[model samples]
Target: MSPEYAIEGAFSIKSDVYGFGVLMIEIVTGKKNRFFTHPDHNLNLLGHTWKSYNEDRLSELIDASILESSDQDEVFRVIAIGLLCVQQYPEDRPTMSSVMKMLTSNITLPRPKQPGFFTERKLEEADTSHSMLCLSSSNHSITTLAPR
Candidate 1:
Protein backbone atom coordinates (compact mmCIF):
# COMPACT_ATOMS: atom_id res chain seq x y z
CA MET A 1 0.00 0.00 0.00
CA SER A 2 1.56 3.21 -1.17
CA PRO A 3 1.16 6.16 1.19
CA GLU A 4 -1.25 7.94 -1.11
CA TYR A 5 -3.58 4.98 -1.44
CA ALA A 6 -3.24 4.09 2.20
CA ILE A 7 -4.08 7.56 3.43
CA GLU A 8 -6.20 9.07 0.64
CA GLY A 9 -7.71 5.96 -0.99
CA ALA A 10 -6.24 7.02 -4.32
CA PHE A 11 -4.82 4.25 -6.44
CA SER A 12 -2.93 4.16 -9.71
CA ILE A 13 -0.19 2.33 -11.60
CA LYS A 14 2.25 4.24 -9.46
CA SER A 15 0.78 2.52 -6.45
CA ASP A 16 1.89 -0.80 -7.90
CA VAL A 17 5.28 0.72 -8.56
CA TYR A 18 5.51 1.60 -4.88
CA GLY A 19 4.66 -1.99 -4.02
CA PHE A 20 7.25 -3.28 -6.45
CA GLY A 21 9.79 -0.97 -4.90
CA VAL A 22 9.11 -2.47 -1.49
CA LEU A 23 9.53 -5.93 -3.01
CA MET A 24 12.82 -4.96 -4.53
CA ILE A 25 14.14 -3.69 -1.23
CA GLU A 26 13.09 -6.84 0.54
CA ILE A 27 14.69 -9.02 -2.11
CA VAL A 28 17.98 -7.21 -1.78
CA THR A 29 18.03 -7.14 2.00
CA GLY A 30 16.40 -10.48 2.77
CA LYS A 31 14.23 -8.59 5.24
CA LYS A 32 10.53 -7.80 5.19
CA ASN A 33 10.04 -4.07 5.01
CA ARG A 34 7.08 -4.02 7.37
CA PHE A 35 8.69 -6.20 10.03
CA PHE A 36 12.28 -5.10 9.61
CA THR A 37 13.88 -3.48 12.62
CA HIS A 38 17.27 -2.00 13.40
CA PRO A 39 18.91 -2.04 16.80
CA ASP A 40 19.87 1.60 16.64
CA HIS A 41 16.91 3.05 14.80
CA ASN A 42 13.16 2.68 14.51
CA LEU A 43 13.18 3.10 10.74
CA ASN A 44 11.34 0.51 8.73
CA LEU A 45 13.36 -1.24 6.03
CA LEU A 46 12.36 1.40 3.49
CA GLY A 47 13.38 4.22 5.77
CA HIS A 48 16.61 2.46 6.65
CA THR A 49 17.39 1.93 3.00
CA TRP A 50 16.80 5.59 2.23
CA LYS A 51 19.14 6.58 5.03
CA SER A 52 21.75 4.05 3.98
CA TYR A 53 21.65 5.11 0.34
CA ASN A 54 22.03 8.77 1.21
CA GLU A 55 24.98 8.01 3.43
CA ASP A 56 26.71 5.92 0.73
CA ARG A 57 26.25 3.01 3.01
CA LEU A 58 24.03 0.90 0.78
CA SER A 59 26.58 -1.86 1.11
CA GLU A 60 25.33 -2.27 4.66
CA LEU A 61 21.81 -3.03 3.44
CA ILE A 62 22.62 -5.84 0.98
CA ASP A 63 22.06 -9.42 2.01
CA ALA A 64 25.39 -11.06 2.68
CA SER A 65 24.21 -14.27 0.99
CA ILE A 66 23.51 -12.45 -2.25
CA LEU A 67 26.50 -10.15 -2.02
CA GLU A 68 28.90 -12.89 -2.98
CA SER A 69 26.91 -14.01 -6.02
CA SER A 70 25.80 -10.62 -7.31
CA ASP A 71 27.65 -7.77 -8.93
CA GLN A 72 27.79 -4.95 -6.41
CA ASP A 73 27.28 -2.16 -8.94
CA GLU A 74 24.27 -3.86 -10.44
CA VAL A 75 22.78 -4.44 -7.04
CA PHE A 76 23.34 -0.83 -6.10
CA ARG A 77 21.63 0.32 -9.28
CA VAL A 78 18.62 -1.85 -8.57
CA ILE A 79 18.43 -0.45 -5.08
CA ALA A 80 18.56 3.03 -6.49
CA ILE A 81 15.74 2.24 -8.88
CA GLY A 82 13.79 0.81 -6.01
CA LEU A 83 14.25 4.05 -4.14
CA LEU A 84 13.02 5.94 -7.19
CA CYS A 85 9.87 3.87 -7.18
CA VAL A 86 9.08 4.65 -3.55
CA GLN A 87 9.61 8.38 -3.78
CA GLN A 88 7.28 10.62 -1.75
CA TYR A 89 4.85 11.28 -4.62
CA PRO A 90 3.38 8.96 -7.24
CA GLU A 91 4.12 11.52 -9.93
CA ASP A 92 7.79 11.25 -9.04
CA ARG A 93 7.99 7.57 -9.80
CA PRO A 94 8.84 6.31 -13.25
CA THR A 95 6.45 4.34 -15.44
CA MET A 96 6.93 0.58 -15.55
CA SER A 97 8.47 0.84 -19.02
CA SER A 98 10.93 3.40 -17.75
CA VAL A 99 11.77 1.18 -14.81
CA MET A 100 12.49 -1.74 -17.13
CA LYS A 101 14.79 0.33 -19.30
CA MET A 102 16.58 1.62 -16.24
CA LEU A 103 17.13 -1.89 -15.01
CA THR A 104 18.47 -3.03 -18.36
CA SER A 105 20.43 0.00 -19.43
CA ASN A 106 23.44 1.77 -17.97
CA ILE A 107 21.92 5.19 -18.36
CA THR A 108 22.47 7.69 -15.61
CA LEU A 109 19.91 7.14 -12.90
CA PRO A 110 18.30 10.14 -11.36
CA ARG A 111 18.92 10.89 -7.69
CA PRO A 112 15.87 9.77 -5.82
CA LYS A 113 14.02 12.17 -3.57
CA GLN A 114 13.01 11.16 -0.06
CA PRO A 115 10.94 8.01 -0.01
CA GLY A 116 7.36 7.72 1.21
CA PHE A 117 6.66 6.00 4.52
CA PHE A 118 10.22 6.77 5.53
CA THR A 119 9.32 8.60 8.70
CA GLU A 120 9.35 7.10 12.15
CA ARG A 121 5.76 6.16 12.90
CA LYS A 122 3.87 6.89 16.05
CA LEU A 123 2.15 3.59 16.66
CA GLU A 124 -0.05 5.06 19.38
CA GLU A 125 -1.71 7.45 16.95
CA ALA A 126 -3.25 4.73 14.81
CA ASP A 127 -4.23 1.10 14.91
CA THR A 128 -1.13 -0.48 13.45
CA SER A 129 -2.79 -3.87 13.13
CA HIS A 130 -5.38 -2.56 10.72
CA SER A 131 -3.73 0.49 9.12
CA MET A 132 -0.95 3.03 9.50
CA LEU A 133 -2.98 5.81 7.98
CA CYS A 134 -3.65 8.79 10.25
CA LEU A 135 -6.78 10.36 8.94
CA SER A 136 -8.16 13.22 10.98
CA SER A 137 -11.18 12.41 13.09
CA SER A 138 -14.27 14.55 12.68
CA ASN A 139 -17.98 14.40 13.42
CA HIS A 140 -20.99 15.63 11.49
CA SER A 141 -24.48 16.55 12.70
CA ILE A 142 -27.70 17.49 10.98
CA THR A 143 -28.75 20.93 12.14
CA THR A 144 -32.12 20.72 10.40
CA LEU A 145 -34.36 17.99 9.08
CA ALA A 146 -34.59 17.70 5.32
CA PRO A 147 -37.01 15.82 3.04
CA ARG A 148 -35.21 14.77 -0.09
Candidate 2:
Protein backbone atom coordinates (compact mmCIF):
# COMPACT_ATOMS: atom_id res chain seq x y z
CA MET A 1 0.00 0.00 0.00
CA SER A 2 1.00 3.63 -0.47
CA PRO A 3 2.06 5.34 2.74
CA GLU A 4 -1.05 7.50 2.80
CA TYR A 5 -3.39 4.61 2.43
CA ALA A 6 -1.38 2.30 4.63
CA ILE A 7 -0.64 4.68 7.47
CA GLU A 8 -3.28 7.38 7.25
CA GLY A 9 -6.19 5.45 5.80
CA ALA A 10 -6.29 7.93 2.96
CA PHE A 11 -7.20 6.96 -0.57
CA SER A 12 -6.80 8.62 -3.94
CA ILE A 13 -5.78 8.04 -7.50
CA LYS A 14 -2.20 8.61 -6.39
CA SER A 15 -2.55 5.52 -4.27
CA ASP A 16 -3.35 3.62 -7.40
CA VAL A 17 -0.35 5.22 -9.01
CA TYR A 18 1.76 3.96 -6.15
CA GLY A 19 0.53 0.44 -6.73
CA PHE A 20 1.22 0.88 -10.42
CA GLY A 21 4.74 1.93 -9.60
CA VAL A 22 5.17 -1.07 -7.37
CA LEU A 23 3.90 -3.26 -10.15
CA MET A 24 6.41 -1.80 -12.55
CA ILE A 25 9.28 -2.25 -10.18
CA GLU A 26 8.09 -5.72 -9.37
CA ILE A 27 8.01 -6.60 -13.03
CA VAL A 28 11.46 -5.19 -13.60
CA THR A 29 12.95 -6.92 -10.61
CA GLY A 30 11.06 -10.14 -11.23
CA LYS A 31 10.33 -9.99 -7.52
CA LYS A 32 7.53 -8.82 -5.32
CA ASN A 33 8.09 -5.79 -3.07
CA ARG A 34 6.06 -7.29 -0.26
CA PHE A 35 8.28 -10.35 0.14
CA PHE A 36 11.56 -8.81 -0.87
CA THR A 37 14.72 -9.67 1.06
CA HIS A 38 18.44 -9.14 0.79
CA PRO A 39 21.16 -10.97 2.62
CA ASP A 40 23.27 -7.84 3.03
CA HIS A 41 20.60 -5.34 3.93
CA ASN A 42 17.31 -5.10 5.79
CA LEU A 43 15.45 -3.23 3.06
CA ASN A 44 12.46 -4.37 1.16
CA LEU A 45 12.82 -4.12 -2.62
CA LEU A 46 11.49 -0.56 -2.60
CA GLY A 47 13.96 0.67 -0.02
CA HIS A 48 16.73 -1.29 -1.64
CA THR A 49 15.99 0.17 -5.07
CA TRP A 50 16.00 3.70 -3.69
CA LYS A 51 19.26 3.00 -1.94
CA SER A 52 20.71 1.43 -5.03
CA TYR A 53 19.83 4.49 -7.13
CA ASN A 54 21.33 6.89 -4.59
CA GLU A 55 24.45 4.76 -4.31
CA ASP A 56 25.07 4.52 -8.03
CA ARG A 57 24.46 0.77 -7.78
CA LEU A 58 21.13 0.66 -9.51
CA SER A 59 22.42 -1.99 -11.88
CA GLU A 60 22.51 -4.37 -8.97
CA LEU A 61 18.75 -4.05 -8.68
CA ILE A 62 18.14 -6.03 -11.83
CA ASP A 63 17.23 -9.65 -11.60
CA ALA A 64 20.23 -11.59 -12.81
CA SER A 65 18.18 -14.00 -14.89
CA ILE A 66 16.89 -11.20 -17.08
CA LEU A 67 19.86 -8.87 -16.98
CA GLU A 68 21.74 -10.67 -19.71
CA SER A 69 18.74 -10.76 -22.04
CA SER A 70 17.22 -7.33 -21.36
CA ASP A 71 18.50 -4.06 -22.72
CA GLN A 72 20.13 -2.35 -19.78
CA ASP A 73 19.13 1.13 -20.86
CA GLU A 74 15.49 0.26 -21.32
CA VAL A 75 15.43 -1.54 -18.00
CA PHE A 76 16.85 1.47 -16.26
CA ARG A 77 14.40 3.71 -18.03
CA VAL A 78 11.50 1.71 -16.72
CA ILE A 79 13.03 1.73 -13.27
CA ALA A 80 13.24 5.49 -13.44
CA ILE A 81 9.60 5.76 -14.41
CA GLY A 82 8.66 3.32 -11.70
CA LEU A 83 10.44 5.36 -9.10
CA LEU A 84 8.74 8.53 -10.29
CA CYS A 85 5.38 6.90 -9.85
CA VAL A 86 6.08 6.02 -6.22
CA GLN A 87 7.30 9.34 -4.90
CA GLN A 88 6.63 9.93 -1.22
CA TYR A 89 3.90 12.49 -1.53
CA PRO A 90 0.75 11.83 -3.48
CA GLU A 91 1.04 15.22 -5.19
CA ASP A 92 4.54 14.27 -6.23
CA ARG A 93 3.46 11.19 -8.16
CA PRO A 94 2.52 11.31 -11.83
CA THR A 95 -0.93 10.95 -13.31
CA MET A 96 -1.75 7.90 -15.41
CA SER A 97 -1.48 9.97 -18.58
CA SER A 98 1.92 11.21 -17.46
CA VAL A 99 3.01 7.64 -16.94
CA MET A 100 1.89 6.77 -20.44
CA LYS A 101 3.90 9.63 -21.81
CA MET A 102 6.86 8.47 -19.81
CA LEU A 103 6.56 4.98 -21.21
CA THR A 104 5.98 6.08 -24.77
CA SER A 105 8.21 9.13 -25.09
CA ASN A 106 11.79 10.09 -24.54
CA ILE A 107 11.09 13.14 -22.42
CA THR A 108 13.57 13.89 -19.72
CA LEU A 109 12.11 12.81 -16.43
CA PRO A 110 12.55 14.66 -13.18
CA ARG A 111 14.49 12.96 -10.41
CA PRO A 112 12.17 10.88 -8.34
CA LYS A 113 12.11 11.72 -4.67
CA GLN A 114 12.03 9.07 -1.95
CA PRO A 115 9.26 6.55 -2.35
CA GLY A 116 6.42 6.30 0.13
CA PHE A 117 6.20 3.54 2.76
CA PHE A 118 9.95 3.07 3.04
CA THR A 119 10.86 1.00 6.08
CA GLU A 120 14.00 -0.82 7.16
CA ARG A 121 14.17 -3.88 9.35
CA LYS A 122 15.54 -7.37 9.45
CA LEU A 123 14.10 -9.98 7.12
CA GLU A 124 13.58 -12.33 10.03
CA GLU A 125 10.42 -10.45 10.71
CA ALA A 126 8.99 -11.07 7.29
CA ASP A 127 5.31 -11.92 7.52
CA THR A 128 5.95 -15.07 5.55
CA SER A 129 8.09 -16.58 8.27
CA HIS A 130 5.21 -18.57 9.64
CA SER A 131 3.87 -19.57 6.28
CA MET A 132 5.04 -22.22 3.86
CA LEU A 133 7.08 -20.84 0.97
CA CYS A 134 7.06 -22.40 -2.46
CA LEU A 135 10.05 -21.13 -4.35
CA SER A 136 10.65 -21.93 -8.00
CA SER A 137 12.00 -20.42 -11.24
CA SER A 138 15.58 -19.90 -10.15
CA ASN A 139 14.39 -19.51 -6.57
CA HIS A 140 13.29 -15.89 -7.03
CA SER A 141 9.74 -15.84 -5.77
CA ILE A 142 7.75 -16.04 -2.54
CA THR A 143 4.02 -16.29 -1.94
CA THR A 144 3.40 -13.99 1.01
CA LEU A 145 3.42 -10.35 2.02
CA ALA A 146 6.55 -8.74 3.59
CA PRO A 147 5.81 -5.03 3.86
CA ARG A 148 8.49 -2.88 5.40
Candidate 3:
Protein backbone atom coordinates (compact mmCIF):
# COMPACT_ATOMS: atom_id res chain seq x y z
CA MET A 1 0.00 0.00 0.00
CA SER A 2 1.09 3.56 -0.62
CA PRO A 3 1.93 5.47 2.58
CA GLU A 4 -0.84 8.01 2.10
CA TYR A 5 -3.42 5.28 1.74
CA ALA A 6 -2.09 3.49 4.77
CA ILE A 7 -1.67 6.50 7.04
CA GLU A 8 -4.07 9.18 5.93
CA GLY A 9 -7.17 7.44 4.54
CA ALA A 10 -6.46 9.13 1.24
CA PHE A 11 -7.15 7.82 -2.25
CA SER A 12 -6.84 9.35 -5.70
CA ILE A 13 -5.63 8.69 -9.21
CA LYS A 14 -2.10 9.19 -7.96
CA SER A 15 -2.62 6.28 -5.62
CA ASP A 16 -3.39 4.12 -8.61
CA VAL A 17 -0.21 5.40 -10.22
CA TYR A 18 1.67 4.23 -7.15
CA GLY A 19 0.17 0.80 -7.57
CA PHE A 20 1.18 0.85 -11.23
CA GLY A 21 4.74 1.52 -10.20
CA VAL A 22 4.67 -1.46 -7.90
CA LEU A 23 3.23 -3.56 -10.68
CA MET A 24 6.09 -2.52 -12.94
CA ILE A 25 8.61 -3.49 -10.31
CA GLU A 26 6.95 -6.84 -9.90
CA ILE A 27 7.14 -7.43 -13.62
CA VAL A 28 10.76 -6.47 -13.89
CA THR A 29 11.84 -8.40 -10.82
CA GLY A 30 9.47 -11.35 -11.17
CA LYS A 31 8.66 -11.05 -7.46
CA LYS A 32 5.53 -10.50 -5.50
CA ASN A 33 5.48 -7.19 -3.60
CA ARG A 34 3.71 -8.72 -0.60
CA PHE A 35 6.35 -11.39 -0.03
CA PHE A 36 9.46 -9.40 -0.88
CA THR A 37 12.14 -9.54 1.80
CA HIS A 38 15.85 -9.07 2.28
CA PRO A 39 17.29 -10.74 5.31
CA ASP A 40 20.40 -8.58 5.62
CA HIS A 41 18.64 -5.20 5.21
CA ASN A 42 15.12 -5.98 6.41
CA LEU A 43 13.71 -4.26 3.35
CA ASN A 44 10.83 -5.05 1.09
CA LEU A 45 11.16 -4.82 -2.69
CA LEU A 46 10.67 -1.06 -3.01
CA GLY A 47 13.14 -0.28 -0.25
CA HIS A 48 15.65 -2.71 -1.66
CA THR A 49 15.25 -1.22 -5.12
CA TRP A 50 15.88 2.26 -3.76
CA LYS A 51 18.94 1.06 -1.90
CA SER A 52 20.25 -0.71 -4.98
CA TYR A 53 19.64 2.33 -7.14
CA ASN A 54 21.41 4.63 -4.76
CA GLU A 55 24.32 2.22 -4.49
CA ASP A 56 24.74 1.77 -8.25
CA ARG A 57 23.82 -1.87 -7.98
CA LEU A 58 20.43 -1.86 -9.66
CA SER A 59 21.45 -4.77 -11.85
CA GLU A 60 21.02 -6.96 -8.80
CA LEU A 61 17.32 -6.17 -8.78
CA ILE A 62 16.52 -7.29 -12.30
CA ASP A 63 14.89 -10.58 -13.04
CA ALA A 64 17.03 -13.13 -14.85
CA SER A 65 14.49 -13.33 -17.61
CA ILE A 66 14.82 -9.64 -18.37
CA LEU A 67 18.55 -9.63 -18.02
CA GLU A 68 18.89 -12.37 -20.58
CA SER A 69 16.35 -11.06 -23.05
CA SER A 70 16.05 -7.30 -22.65
CA ASP A 71 18.26 -4.29 -23.25
CA GLN A 72 19.79 -3.22 -19.96
CA ASP A 73 19.36 0.48 -20.63
CA GLU A 74 15.68 0.10 -21.35
CA VAL A 75 15.18 -1.93 -18.21
CA PHE A 76 16.92 0.70 -16.14
CA ARG A 77 14.81 3.46 -17.64
CA VAL A 78 11.61 1.60 -16.85
CA ILE A 79 12.73 1.04 -13.28
CA ALA A 80 13.48 4.72 -12.85
CA ILE A 81 10.03 5.61 -14.11
CA GLY A 82 8.50 3.13 -11.68
CA LEU A 83 10.31 4.70 -8.78
CA LEU A 84 9.17 8.14 -9.87
CA CYS A 85 5.57 7.00 -9.77
CA VAL A 86 5.97 5.76 -6.23
CA GLN A 87 7.48 8.87 -4.68
CA GLN A 88 6.47 9.68 -1.11
CA TYR A 89 4.15 12.52 -2.06
CA PRO A 90 1.44 12.26 -4.70
CA GLU A 91 2.37 15.66 -6.05
CA ASP A 92 5.94 14.50 -6.52
CA ARG A 93 4.77 11.83 -8.89
CA PRO A 94 4.27 12.44 -12.59
CA THR A 95 0.88 12.34 -14.21
CA MET A 96 -0.06 9.26 -16.24
CA SER A 97 0.43 11.15 -19.50
CA SER A 98 3.85 12.21 -18.34
CA VAL A 99 4.61 8.61 -17.56
CA MET A 100 3.65 7.58 -21.08
CA LYS A 101 5.92 10.20 -22.55
CA MET A 102 8.74 9.08 -20.33
CA LEU A 103 8.30 5.49 -21.43
CA THR A 104 8.05 6.19 -25.13
CA SER A 105 10.39 9.12 -25.54
CA ASN A 106 14.04 9.78 -24.71
CA ILE A 107 13.33 12.95 -22.72
CA THR A 108 15.41 13.30 -19.61
CA LEU A 109 13.67 12.27 -16.40
CA PRO A 110 13.98 13.94 -13.05
CA ARG A 111 15.90 12.03 -10.45
CA PRO A 112 13.59 9.95 -8.29
CA LYS A 113 13.35 10.80 -4.64
CA GLN A 114 13.11 8.18 -1.94
CA PRO A 115 10.01 6.09 -2.20
CA GLY A 116 7.29 5.80 0.46
CA PHE A 117 7.48 3.18 3.24
CA PHE A 118 11.18 2.69 2.64
CA THR A 119 12.85 0.90 5.58
CA GLU A 120 16.38 -0.19 6.47
CA ARG A 121 15.99 -1.68 9.93
CA LYS A 122 17.55 -5.03 10.66
CA LEU A 123 15.33 -8.05 11.17
CA GLU A 124 15.81 -7.91 14.92
CA GLU A 125 14.76 -4.29 14.95
CA ALA A 126 11.53 -5.24 13.21
CA ASP A 127 10.42 -7.51 16.04
CA THR A 128 7.18 -6.43 17.70
CA SER A 129 8.68 -6.18 21.15
CA HIS A 130 10.27 -2.85 20.33
CA SER A 131 7.48 -1.51 18.13
CA MET A 132 4.83 0.98 19.10
CA LEU A 133 1.35 -0.36 19.79
CA CYS A 134 -1.59 0.67 17.68
CA LEU A 135 -5.21 0.24 18.77
CA SER A 136 -6.73 -0.14 15.33
CA SER A 137 -5.95 -1.71 11.97
CA SER A 138 -5.75 0.36 8.81
CA ASN A 139 -8.01 -0.68 5.99
CA HIS A 140 -6.18 -1.53 2.76
CA SER A 141 -8.99 -1.89 0.28
CA ILE A 142 -8.99 0.60 -2.59
CA THR A 143 -12.09 2.78 -2.40
CA THR A 144 -13.78 3.06 -5.75
CA LEU A 145 -15.21 6.28 -7.18
CA ALA A 146 -17.99 6.49 -9.75
CA PRO A 147 -17.69 8.75 -12.79
CA ARG A 148 -18.91 12.30 -12.25
* lDDT values for all models: 0.87, 0.85, 0.84
Q: Could you give candidate 1's per-residue lDDT for residues 97-137 as a string of tens digits?
A: 99999999999999999999997754443236325323333
Ranking by lDDT: 1, 2, 3
Q: Once superposed on the true structure, which residue ranges of model 3 sit more than 4 Å away at CA?
A: 120-148
Model 3, range 1-148, lDDT digits (tens) per residue? 7778977778867998898899998899998665576766678788888888899887889999899999999999999999998899999999999999999999999999999878656555455423432323465445678553
Residue 57, model 1: Cα distance from true site in angstroms: 0.7
Q: What is the Cα-based lDDT of residue 12 in candidate 3?
A: 66
By TM-score, the best candidate is 2
After TM-score superposition, the amount by which residue 65's alpha carbon in candidate 1 deviates from its true location, in angstroms, is 1.1
Off by over 4 Å in 2: 127-148
TM-score of each: 0.82, 0.82, 0.80
Reference-based lDDT, residue 113, model 3: 99
Measured with C-alpha atoms, the lDDT of residue 55 in candidate 3 is 93
lDDT of 2 at 94: 95
Return the clash pairs for model 3, or none. Answer: none
Residue-level lDDT tens digits of model 2 in 1-148 = 8888877778988898999999999988888887887888878889988998888786888888768898888789889899998888999999999999999988998999988777787656685552444333375665776655
Identify the superior model by TM-score, candidate 2 or candidate 3. Answer: 2
